[model samples]
Target: MRITADRTRCVGSGLCAERLPDVFDQDDDALVLLCADEVPAGLRQDVEEAVQRCPTEALSLDADAPEH
Candidate 1:
């Protein structure tokens, strides 16, 4: 799976970063920042949870998506 974050849509709630700091973070402006686009096999479930918890729905998981 691949993780994607839309900063423009982010509310900077820090839920993703708080839940899974390994994959998500906050920029200086407190917007969502993706630590990595590629999701490790073990972290997929946690990442999904984080995405779902995002209040702004700015985070997403794309299964088997091609690299940009």
Candidate 2:
């Protein structure tokens, strides 16, 4: 799966980072940062959870897309 975030829609809530630190993080300004755009199979489930928990719906996953 591939994941991306829309910064304009983010609220700096940090929930994604909290739920999946290995794939998400907060910059110095506390904006959401994607640590891994091309998710490995092992981390797909956790990444999906993070996307679902995003309050502002800033996180997105393209599960059907071909891996880059």
Candidate 3:
């Protein structure tokens, strides 16, 4: 799956980073940043949880997209 973040909608709640630090992080301004554009096979579940738990709905996954 491919993960994408909408920075404009991020509230910097840190939930995404807290749920999956390997794939999400907070910038100096406390905005959400994607650590990896492509989700790692082992971290798909964590990514999904992060997306689901994102209060602002800023995190999204494109499961049907072709892998690069």
In lDDT terms, which candidate is top? 3
- CA lDDT of every candidate: 0.87, 0.86, 0.90
Candidate 2 local lDDT, 1-68, one digit each (tens): 78899988988999998888888889888889988888766887788888899999999998798844
Residues 1-68, model 3: lDDT tens digits: 78999999999999988888889999998899998999988988888888999999999999899866
Quote the positional error of residue 18 for candidate 3 in Å: 1.4
Quote the positional error of residue 23 for candidate 3 in Å. Answer: 0.4
TM-scores for all predictions? 0.90, 0.87, 0.91
**Which residue pairs come into collision in candidate 2?**
none
- Candidates 2 and 3 compared: the better one by TM-score is 3
Report the poorest 10 consecutive residues by lDDT, candidate 2.
39-48
Where's the lowest-lDDT run of ten residues in candidate 3?
40-49
TM-score of 2: 0.87
